[model samples]
Target: MLATPPPYPSTIVTSTNHPEPPQITIKPVDRRRILASLAATITPFFSPHYPHLNSDQFPHIPVSFLPVANARGLFQMPPVRLSNRYFLVRAGESEFESLGIINTNPVAKTSVDNGLSTIGKKQTVKAALRLKEMGACDNSCWIWPSITQRAYQAAEIIAAVNGVNRSNIVPEYSFLDARGLGAYEGKALQSVSEIYASDLVSPDIKPPPINDGTPNESVADVFVRVTQLMSILETQYSEDTVIIVSPDSDNLTILQAGLVGLDLRRHSELAFEPGEVRFFDPSSIPTYKQPASALYKCPNPPSCK
Candidate 1:
């Protein structure tokens, strides 16, 4: 019948219906085993420090110029007027390592005293008070903290200053975890320098309190959360909404990358200190694209819940 199906070729007949599974290529992320090694690579190449540029100083640079990476995908929002929104302040001038080390683990405070810590908790409160004086106080105000203690504490201090009850503050814990690229949790909090060197590195990767075994949220993840949070705030109220964020340059860079819809490599470097506040009025410049929801997921796993 039909010339015996043209005498099926052995390789063609077997392979046609069932092709071999595509090879799964996983590039190794653990290139450096020591913190020093990773830090050496990143810090020198992209020096994480930059002086704050004032609007007057940069006459050529618009008060709101989109970083080149995000120019193409930028979206326009309403105009930003100073009377409408308050400054979105990052906390103090603390170094990344010092703050990271202080709040790396959760602390149990019996007093819950705002003025008790040298790590800038008191000043953070004052900063929020300043915001309140500027007419930014509202029950619907949003406050976000990364999963880290420093961020959480910093936000808590600000809420305290504003007299914003715990129930009123919106905690977007998902925005925590400064690790830029994606990787397993628990291990992600390690400093860039700590993770890459062989001799200095620990053999065991710490599992996150959230036990689902997923990597900590990526930089892309936070950007998406920030965008969604913004949307939710916008939908609920037509007026200006105040937001408090606790993130440094690395985290901000990722947020910038996500907002601009640019590839990871396209983002400009960023650095924000603790207690430092920078205001962004979405109305002032073109609104950047909010990242797709597919890239965002709760950083905490079920176990943590």
Candidate 2:
């Protein structure tokens, strides 16, 4: 969201969930080259022919946030000093996702047709029960779900299980929607790799506009809005747990990447399966970590392991 970074205090603020986020390495990450080299490894996930391939099929090394999205981008954004705990979650799988198709149009996504399938409903209920087990919403907690029907429904389920007031459950319309697949809407689900492939190149690159439908988006497009959402949450709440329910994996991953100060381009590596719950407990933030050299008598982080 910002081109020029804000003031730095010699040390960057990072999320508690991320002890060691991605950092610049000796060979700077070249997006085009990396994607080209990783074709055999990365391309198959989006190919229907490779249905057996796992979403996380390989050992993921962190990549630099270089394919600059928007002239000024979000990679430069430092983590916020959170006054409250935050939990990032994904809604259950949608009909399109289970059907092996795509849909990002706001109009269609909110409809009953694109809502959660039977499995999705179960998954959402299970996630809500987990939150209740953790007692995360027993106190003054707030719930924010994206505008997607599935996410909103998931929020309701969580509230129902934890006895949260309906008023405390808010619907976030903009920031946490599924990453718009743009021209790829209604296509095979595997087509998502095409969007991810483009994302590896730059955040500003919009998907090709097709027949006046859900316009595709660049990663930075999501970054800016997610940033706004985080700012609002941090500014509005304090010392309480705030659970954010997203309709898709990308929104949670993207938001986590930004909060933990990882290279925005490598956001996909921080994935969340449907109905998964992960949290950021700012109270657990450690003031610092000893350098590897000091810990294991090694010269660097990679050497320590």
Candidate 3:
């Protein structure tokens, strides 16, 4: 019968109709876990901090006030003009993005604030595919911690699908977390939108009332933080391309930083949907050549003028 199927121990039967499976070697160490741990530890230290010096001594300068340069020196590159370009992507839909109810009020009768909940798998897979189609797979990504679980998972899926190494993903906290909703954090967007129309009109306006003494940050704060992060990225990744994942509010703030000259009041005018990807090239913006007179203003009253 079928030539006795060959001897069991001495010989193995061949399947000429089927191809042999590819060999997969497992590594002793999990390199992805190591890289993630390293990134988490070192990322916070890279956040740019604004000094609290006196305005008279050190006036608050706008990003446009900086000079432009290409070389590496003290005033080499412009603080706003990046030597390399990157993509800013809004994280995929969580409950918040989907317009679901979230209750920030701990004492409220009803609350649905599931901290760190991620989006559905279908959306995650779709987002990853889109990023790959856009050529994002060619570079590494920097993601925020709040959205890390979902974003990192998507990155992993993308890498696996493309046979890419998964170690390129890193965590970044420079981009501020989602706008603290305070009492509104856990409330449904529709309910909040209807209840607090005026305050929602401009995030910088009177912020939502505190929930249990927890204060939320204004849109202006987000603008300042985003600008600082942009400066840091421009300097650090001057010669490389990178991807950033952030929430809708923070992503809008980033676009505002690049488009509206970092004006806080103008931030409300910008809107970005979740999972949207936008490209920014700092070099496209014309550099502001500071007037010589403006450089050294007379500090001693009007006598010098």
Candidate 4:
């Protein structure tokens, strides 16, 4: 249903990039869950409401709630449609950014070194206040932020302002992480242009690896992951408002390009600044600018890169 959609509304906010996934931690199994599962099975078998029902179907195989159709054909994805309105927020400036250094390395994502600075915090707070003013929080909403310290900190500020529950503030690891700079780890902030230069040449290009501290990423690589994130969100939610917080601009820009049906190579032109917020129409066409074959890769990205 999306066709030549209108430009999204952009408001001041606070944002960064990609590369590595956060370390995973497994949680201990809950005994209560096991008992609950057993009770569901036993009660269903004995309840008068279903006295003759098949016990073999004890654990119901939840049928797909979404309608199925072949109109789009087998390899083609449905239109870029979302049940809720999404507001994209770029995280505020970080401590390293304040020093003119670029820090998208996942190893330091949680370190205070990559966290927000005074100006950045102010930016995030202002953006959150703006969202509150917009009535986005009148009903329940969810905030999804990159795992980076800066992005998560911004999420916290929004939650505090809107009174959103901490449980709804989710940390996005794969799709929303700052773009990794690989060997460019401690380089000057302006060095990001060097990476984007390669990206324009081909989305498959990667930044040089000094030693894989944080491998670099190609625009195409980011396109794939962000597309995955969109797929998940579109399928799981509806009639809701989801705030996407990123520590850098590249990921969000790439996402916007995909949303608006622009060429992937043109993504840099859509650069968004830190603490900026924007909204796009989900019914837009061409959700992802997928190519015919594999080309560039990622391991990176920096905002504006």
Best by TM-score: 4
Among all windows of ten consecutive residues in candidate 3, which has the lowest summed lDDT?
Answer: 107-116
What is the TM-score of candidate 2? 0.66
- List TM-scores for all candidates, in order: 0.43, 0.66, 0.56, 0.69
Task: Give the CA lDDT, 0 to 100, for residue 199 in model 4.
Answer: 73
Which structure is stronger by TM-score: 1 or 3? 3
* Ranking of candidates on lDDT, top first: 4, 2, 3, 1
When sorted by TM-score, best at the front, the candidate numbers are 4, 2, 3, 1
Clash count for each candidate, listed in order shown = 24, 2, 4, 30
* RMSD of each predicted structure: 23.5, 24.2, 21.9, 22.4
Error of 1 at 282 (Å): 2.6
| CA lDDT, every model vs. true structure | 0.46, 0.76, 0.51, 0.78
Candidate 4 local lDDT, residue 256: 83
Per-residue C-alpha lDDT of model 1 across residues 1-305, encoded as one tens digit per residue: 45544232223333657887544444455654444344433333332232343334443443224132111222222222122343456654333344343222222111133112465665567667766776566545656655455556667777787777777556555543443322322242354433323212332222233434334333334455555644544444445555656544445554444444445443333445556565654454444455677566766875442
- Score candidate 1 by lDDT: 0.46
For model 1, give the RMSD to the true fold: 23.5
Candidate 1: deviation at residue 174, Å?
1.8
Residues 1-305, candidate 3, lDDT per residue (tens digit)?
56754332343335668746644444477887676555444433443442332234434433233233345433222243555656666555654445575433223211233222355445555655776787764664543222344444444554565445656555554453455556566566665444335445664654467647534656555555666666666656656656665544444544445443644444444555555656765655656788786798776887885
